[model samples]
Target: MTPPNPQDALRAAAAHVSRRRFFTVTGAAAALAFSVGLPQAHADEPADPGTVRQEPFTLGVASGDPAPDGVVLWTRLAPAAFEPDGGMPPAPFLVDWEVAHDEGFHRVVRRGRELAHPEFHHTVHVEVDGLAPGRPYYYRFRLGPWISPVGRTSTAPPQHARNSAMRFGVVACQNYPGGYYTAFKHLANEDLDAVFHLGDWIYEGAVSATGGSRAYPAGTLPAVFNHETVTLEDYRLRYALYRSDADLRAAQAAHPWILTWDDHEVENNYAGAISQDNLPPDEFLVRRAAAYRAYWENQPLRRPQRPRGADLRLYRRLHYGTLAQFDVLDGRQYRSDQAFGGAWARPGGDADDPARAMLGERQEHWLADGWRDSRARWNIVPQQVVLAERRSEPTEAYTVSMDAWDGYTAARTRFLDAAEAAGVENLVVLTGDVHVHYAMDVKRDYADPGAPAVASEIVATSISSGGNGAERPASYDRLTKANPHLRFYDGRRGYVTVALDREQCRADFRVVPYITTEGAPVATAASYAIEAGRPGLHRV
Candidate 1:
């Protein structure tokens, strides 16, 4: 059967949605609307009455993009998550939310109401403000008789305040069909200030009836997920399938998340508007628009993160008092196309071109300016790809991944140069995508063996993507030998926890033994630390 056109699907969804529900307010109008709160209605008096059945919060609740003053709380009214319309009516539904100082909600701090419009897949993102900074808060949603699971979130410390310590979890690359979300289950229990998810939240491929390695019952997942995602509805349903995982939901509820997409959220190894299959830019953009919109709908992001067609400005900076500054980057969105036909190629030609950009020209400037303006103790870069150079062949002539920073040599040099010029004291880059844990020294010059390390990079392994990985994969020895800057490597499935203080930053690589089965135990594969003034990784 021929697949439905993405543009047509988007247009059809838009046509069915009410204009009043679709239109969004901005500036003073938005401020007034949110400040006064949305029109409140009981579940019985819903705009589309009698449309909801079962529990509407099957996908669960989440919080994210924390600030000193506020955090965004998110939930979607999806009684049937896998359905084309998420089993909701074509009208808006009222969702009530409250923030409390305690999980039991004996002391309420903030309360408001928002409309969950079908135009946005019945999703609501409530940016709750007017709260004390650097304190934990519990929140939940109320839709008539049903109440969402309580979520824990916290605001960052005041901008100039001197924070003594901060901790966060780094995770990425969770492909649903490949394995279970056992890593997320473990991550849910970790004590973290926030979680940085570096993308590949969902794969864009088809799923088997038995749910691949998960070995679910033959008819467990809906048949709708057996095909690759293409349309807005397809992407929306895909997110629903992933979000249906209880472990993933638990982690999201446990801590506020700061997320950025790599590839596989839309398509694998996509660069800018270019797709891996090399489809026409216009056609690819339509699919991208669908993916971006669905991503925003499902995520706990603020209004500015919303997509305008295929474009979404995802790169931004967040401060944790004066202790750390997180520059969450969107590597897949603005990068130049991979050189020499992409992936595992010997560097030359376009790879050496001085004009090749990884973060785009505008973002490069923005990053440099941010570095110059930053006053935080540690400059933390939460990005999608590996920043340090990795040589696959242990020889003078080595091959590297064209899809990574190695593909843009001049751009990498410029980045290091900018950091040096900005006088960045402690630079720590947190990365995900390689599906293996790696602690490497970000050097000013990879060719110079004696060059001083300029930064430290901690690459977290996948949450589940590569199945049950070995302690040392086949390429482990060769890659580590070829790249002297690499301090440690582990091919395991799990997340990483980084703790930062006045003197040093330490990263603990936490790994689960297996993900193909349930109830796997987690262990610390390795731990590394970087001193405040030092850049290289030291085994701790």
Candidate 2:
């Protein structure tokens, strides 16, 4: 057989970094290698940097990845976000952060000073601890006398504590240039315990005027923001552009976010270290590392999730008392290169390769173990792509997008089988990417003519990725008819609001009528529920 292509070979090699090898790597050596690629430091903060001329907290503040004792606070000092250096001199600045029980900071619980280093775009990530569990807190950052907007976040309940109900707002795929973030504005208004961002938080490509409801002004398109992101600066600039949106900022401040990335955060349809343009492994790995680093710096994630070399540890578990257990997974990093060279491929042949994986070996094992050991009432997997099989055409001979779960039939089967064998009764798979909303019953064996539905998959619509979309496209109607397991489908821009309890899980498909303009009203396109015992969706 012809030697595997460079990308495939590279993936195989990377997958060999087993748990043993990962633990054996010296922390000092890893840190030393990681420090080499950091951008040059700017001047250290002087006693006073003269009259503070820049508004550093323009991107606003956010908190995410909440645990019972602590949550991660984030704010980047970007006065001019679109600029290469965010218009900051190379320097380390002392930024102060406070967590208070009240919005007025009258009862300050935790306060600290952190350095906003130039290397990470002067972003400060504070992992605050020693707070009450299952409670809300107000937080803000300060630079000199300037204070950021006070944001709200809550800690998860103690791991084994019993809680009656929990609510979450699921959002994803907000392409900056597509339209305004009216969806986020509405999402901020909802009363939610936390938010789960499934991925594509920022698209890495330049904006075009032809496809969106409203287009960015020509004057606002800086040279740095108009091209595909390849370097660290480019990715940082892309995130800055997205973070500048008022609605996006509001959504971030409204609740703590659980974040994981899909392809657009780096490039469209990229698999592992493979680029869409098919660049060499070494060259593409450099770009991958840059993307990973920038992703870490921009989000409200803890230090443990920071990128080490080209690897970022994102797949982990979070518990919300005894109500639910969240297995936030990373699907892009360790996945095998898409079959047919990352293009549309037939469902047989290489697509059936048992070695082909979406979560690689370690993460797949981790998820299975989590399923077996979970004690919460609900086991929710917030992941990147759809877990159920979806075909571009109805026929078995047709092609499917190899970038999704359909590309790895054996792996998907193995995972579903393991989940079923684990007796996971209340398993729910939440997904984003594909820019549409879908509610499907995840079959234990899709290939079996009489396969049983073992789980429910609710796929959220993009925040604004596909511009203003239709409520019911003709193709969507046909798709639902062809796949009986698919209960609901909509091509629109919005998100899914879910409430879980001991009895059942309720999902509301919230959609915005338009996105090209601002202040568009949101409506519930449909509501679905999965009872405690039954796995399929019951329309409400």
Candidate 3:
């Protein structure tokens, strides 16, 4: 059916409401849409729910932040996803949603309506509650005659229940122009209960019209995407482009995701409110606010994660009964500026300053408190950046990545100390953002060669970043030799699958050999098991 013109719909709706009320509502939404210098939409009437003609669910559906009672269902009305306003009029549309026990809506448990507001890019975040725990549910969205693709999600077990096993996937660093999302296609087929996206979800760099490494034909992407993203509309359009990937949409539809951001979501190697290029704090904050706002609108995040200016409270906890407790952290938002100028560098006195924090003081305290109260068998910390120290030269020179936990020596010590104080026996750190897979033993003291292992770290490779990587990069041998705690390392494009039981946590390093072309087969390049009470990696 031909869709009703947005202008016509607005004119029809204007006849129903007082002119003052119509302008009051539509003006507010338009103001928000153009807040970051995006072109203003024409002043119009309130949206009529029945007038929506185009299919609004072009970006597909997703579920996230699954609780014991329910999960958050998400979708956006993006009939013209590439457009700055997502092709919707500057108004609100009432969206209908349903949660069902089966794929078909015959066994629906809950159904409701929510307004997709233009102020939030017409995205819907349905925090559905009052459902049975530890069971799967199907969800979909509706707007007039349009229906979203069905998404499958499940809740955690009862808070204190003795859940035996929990399996999940860890992924990160999906640079849209770098390669195809071949790994995500394979990941979507995995038997995972949930997915932990450890940030760098979208790169903020410019995309060539040819689409970088994948090399799409000329004119495939718009000229607007050829420049760096700084404004709210820019970030939103970038997400729209990335979400257009079928593999990514498939993964989101297949399982719920828990996510946090790394530097590239705003600027590469940025720290806190500081921009990498040293832009003034106020100027950088404006950009950060835009990035954060677009991030929330695109992802399957709840209202609690919505951005308030440049600030967003992303660090939080999730429990899977007695099996595991996931402390998803935000390493980029509140961190101190990278010591000795970011990226690979030698340590300096500032790197060891106790006052400097990776998670900031407040979030550090929150994480420690959560650990003290956690009753789960395995305490999993899903966060951005590598937690273990990797020496560059495999010698005593002490060259390391200032962007990672290695740069914040005292902060790393504080984290381990707090975990130890809280009696966290089975600690597993899930990390991303180096574009490589690494299995390392978290040492009590990196300075001491004989230090005991305090925890285990499983770092997942990128979904498709750094192109198709090698099994062993040039410095692989040196890195392993330098850090004795480093058990395994691989440079490939894929994700990591983790399974936790009462006895042990197993990590399978899944890899796809090629991403420049589509349909690459995925395989487990390596596997390691971290036994409970023994915080170290054991090849299996």
Candidate 4:
């Protein structure tokens, strides 16, 4: 049928705003349109049986991967008796959407239809397009009568727009047990053009085995009592608990997000077929499919996430006002299995074997092409982990996750090599998941001090996954000191705000005191700037 009436959508949405709820998740039976053959297992189940009968929705709403004319909106419609790991009854819901120029639904600009069904675990992803470029916009969702909380979004500048400066918040790894998302509150409040979730969007279900804990501020980390998240239900619970955080909701409301998956989004140091920390190969593909699909569903991504088994394309590109281009890469999928486990990685064993690839052949080509074709003044590769080469001095153990650039040394070298070939000026690597921040000159060969700096790497610390802000003194201090190319380093729980101007790109490392509590204030720990045509980063 036609999109649930725009007025109906607003009434449903307005009702949610009245509740003073920033994220309103509603679930109902006729959620999905007929004809999307749901599995029998899912069909014979009750719909919308959540504990809180008064509320029809489940979880909240979020948006990501924004462009000048489009952005991805997301939500999960949990079925009745939803358990942690799959096997819950199938849920089918018709997710209605609305976009307004004002938060009060004054000017309804776009309306759309999305199907939340069993085929995709009841999670809704609607990528709305044709929005005004370089301007802020408000949005929300609707069910039969229930509406989601109002969220805000903005698009990238259209191609013809000129001299338009843009600001974005960069971050990753917000583990529940490590701390709270207190930083999210400030990130939401801080005016920004968009948000870049570099990676570690969600930790897997097997925290105990990962040498991590489950005690977060609000509630226990969602877990599968019997096994890790090998099924849809396991992944569902994981997102449910994560979205429940008020800080996270506020951040989701503030701006559109550009996201990618780090190892922990599925499993620590996991790759195509192998998982770090000793996981069975057989348990992986199915597990990955669930994780990938769940991740795609819960986030505001485009049609790319319409899962084809376990593989979802998280790699995407966004352009901003001819000033910058962002290539958000996926680090975990399409990578070789962990070459070495834990602190002692073994990538050197058959490291040059062409068969061994980190980004696989396709992603490698895609990145290479992006470097060659980008016309923006700056080219940003927003991915996970650090890009600076590891320099060893024998003072301590320094092992690279074979799943990281370190494991795929040859591949990363190729990427840099292509940049050189493409003459891609102002190449910058935007990284996350190390739980430590750094600003370093990216040399094609980290082993050579005399080697020219071809680009810069700005590594963002955790939103709140690592230890106390000062806990990892050695990790930050020692790394910067030992590596001459490393200009700045800090272990803080916060995010980065990068402001671009015609003169320079200034990255202000903003750290929140803590996320384990509400009302954490944000401050700039340091700032670094890369002058136009400089080719390398410099401390400001």
- Listed in order, each prediction's TM-score against the native is 0.91, 0.92, 0.92, 0.83
| TM value for model 3 | 0.92
lDDT for each residue of candidate 4 in 412-484, tens digit (9 for 90 to 100): 7778888888899888889987787788898866656788888988888898786457634665555655588
Among the numbered candidates, top lDDT falls to 3
Q: Which tens-of-lDDT digit does each residue in 1-540 have in candidate 2?
A: 223356555557754543234336545334433333454545445334333568889999999999999999999987777788787777777888999999999999999998887777789999999989999999999988788999999999999999999999999999887888999999999999999999999888776533234565655565656677877777887888788889999999999999999998888888776678867555566677778889999999998899876789999999999889999999998888788876777776666777678998899889999989989899999999888877665666656778888888788988888888789888899999978889999885555646778899999999998889998865775576557788899999999999999999999999998898887999999999999978988799
Candidate achieving higher TM-score, 1 or 3: 3
Which portions of model 4 show Cα errors greater than 4 Å? Answer: 1-53, 78-91, 205-227, 277-282, 345-355, 392-401, 515-518
Clashing pairs in model 2? 42-90, 42-91, 43-90
lDDT of 1 by residue, 241-306 (tens): 899899999999999999999999999988776789867555566677678888988999999998
Error of 1 at 385 (Å): 0.7
Deviating ranges (above 4 Å) for candidate 3: 1-46
> How many backbone clashes are present in model 1?
0
Q: All candidates' lDDT scores?
A: 0.86, 0.84, 0.87, 0.69
Whole-model lDDT, model 1:
0.86
For model 4 the local lDDT of residue 280 reads 44
